[model samples]
Target: MKNLIAATYAPMHTDGSLNTDKIKDYSQFLTKNNVSGVFMNGSTGDFTSLTIDERKAITLAWSENKSKDLYLIDHVGDPSLKVAKELAQYASDKVDAIAAIAPFYFRLNSIDKLIDYCKEIAICAPNLPFYYYHIPVLSGAQLNMASFLEQAKDNIPNLAGIKFTNNDLIDYGHCKSKANSKYNILFGYDELFINSLPLGATGWVGSTYNHLAPLYYKIKELFENGNMEAAADLQSKAIKFVELLNSKGGFNGVGKGFMRVLGVDCGPSRFPHTTLSDSDYIEIKEALDGIGLKSWFSK
Candidate 1:
């Protein structure tokens, strides 16, 4: 659960069918690159683009490839509480942990409501740990997680921590400092992993971890060695890498395609997610090299 945890993309064949065949290789690829965990079926995995059966197949695939080195945290969030519960129950025995975001359709209006939503889902997997995926920009449930911890701490018995995916560093710091530092506040702003260090964050979950793990580890190493200038420089380059492709189109799809440059093709993105041509990637690679990030690509 600590260190870099990749929010993996769902591998698909050209026909847009689930290609669970590559799950093991994906796991090994991540492990070889120094990634410690895989956070599956999250936003990066294009969960919203998948059907219930396909999602189930993904869970089964990852579960079968589960290893001691790669901790799996399945994001079981769905707009329907019933569906989220089903997903939670389905992933209960399969993953190392389970997480759910607030129901986005009618989004939970209060911290209490969110707690209630999480409690039901957590109870479904009573034996396993539960994480609340707090990404307000997407879910529209922008409550203070510090307050969430105050109210939810005792209520949800298995509330392991949060997949904190926002830039409210103030509230994030509060969550980190809450209740004698009881919860595992996994920082989610990939571009701001440098900022999290000052706040005492050790774990992070992000999609870019899939591409730039070794680079991040080097950043961590440099920072811990008192080379703030070098660490911040690399961190800024990483941020630039995201901005570069994000400028071309949307980042999610472009970034997913960049996985192939590192020798693992995650395949074409689904509808609304643009898949780049090999030439597009080649051009992007040239752009990456221009910024002195050629060596950072995951291998």
Candidate 2:
């Protein structure tokens, strides 16, 4: 799962039903843009808003749509151990890998508990590589991830690495520097991608990649070419893009809707995630075009 892995949106009908049918075009759109994989049903996929059946349907759709050009990393986390386990088992045969965040409802108070929780889920898919979805801001389990790398390294047999989604550079740096550099610490904060490049981050999984893979790939190219100034400038524009959509309603809703501007209509977001009017998208299109990010989308 190196390079860009888009944490994709759950395509839905306006009536809030899962539109799993869209995964084929979605997969092709991603591959066309050079995104290497899909991080299915993660935060950006609005997993929390979906029912277990719905999430499973989403997983099955992605699994069925699997291609040589795109890998699938299914996020199987759920507050219910049974549900998480079930999803993990379901993904075992379907996806290239599986991932789970700490159960967020009650919260795991200790790293030991997190390891136990992850281990249980991970064992269900022993054949598939597992990644701990470490997005503490959303999960509320802010245990030191460096310690997770140290502790979990030996515990979870299928553990491949961390889908690191926080802003703590110190901890991130420590995780990347883990002895032998075993894990695939997939940096998830899209805006901070350029910053992670210097630390040797190769794989990145995030929502914005669904919309701006070309832009980010270019950013990586610029950074790799020693053009720090241009990379930083593009990175700033990405932040601006998120902030701009965020101001309209919320970024997840607006940004997912922004996919239409990129030529793939992911349809409306689920409940609690505001859906925008067509006019809103028009205004967003104008705003993004004004900022010179129009060329980043797939034509």
Candidate 3:
């Protein structure tokens, strides 16, 4: 739960089947860019569209290419608790850590229910650190995260921290102060990385980090050097990167294609997420250049 962790894309074949062969190169690419960790089988990965077996395959591929410098965090969340537990068990031995988003379909309205759900999955991977992926937008469980940490601390033994994707800075502050700043609250909102620094965010997990690691590292450096204005400007540029890609169909699909521009060749995204043609990528890159983001692209 330190430094930038890319919520990785699940590489696919043209037929929309899992192309795990690309993962070795994907891992190498992230490491080359100095992205310290990978959060696979999560939203950026289109986990909801993939089968349990497919999700497991993604984890295995990453595990095989695992490096000391690049740690792996497999997101084992599923609407089905059984499936989540199964994925957790499968990932337990393979990854450095594991995370689970709340059951998105049914939705856990109460904190206790969420803790119970996490508790079950945590026990499956008792040895590995557990992270609760608190992305309320997609999960639909907008319960207070601070309250969750207060309650879950005692019940869940392996509870390391939360991937706080929500934008509620007040609640994020409360979560950071909880247990005397004990839990590793890895901020998940890419656009708000600078904002989180004031609240003491040492770790981050985001899709944008996949493309702009150096930019973010620079942002952090500027902020630490007491250059708030420059940090804000760079953060604005990073946000523009997201907005630019999102303008082309949707960011999820378009962003995956941008990976190819970085030389990973993750192939195309699945249905509902618009897959861009080669010409479309050219247009997208041109658009990025127009916004002055070409220099920030992950190396």
lDDT of 3: 0.92
Clashes of 3: 0
Weakest lDDT window of 10 consecutive positions for candidate 1: 176-185
Q: What is the lDDT of every predicted structure here?
A: 0.91, 0.90, 0.92
Candidate 2 stretches with Cα past 4 Å from truth are none
Q: Could you give candidate 2's per-residue lDDT for residues 150-223 as a string of tens digits?
A: 88878897889999999988888888888345788999998899989988889999999988888899999998
User: TM-score for every candidate vs. truth?
Assistant: 0.98, 0.98, 0.98
Give lDDT tens digits, candidate 3, residues 129-160: 99999999999999999999989888999899
Write the number of the candidate with greater lDDT, choosing between 1 and 3.
3
Candidate 1 Cα RMSD after full superposition onto the native fold (Å): 0.9
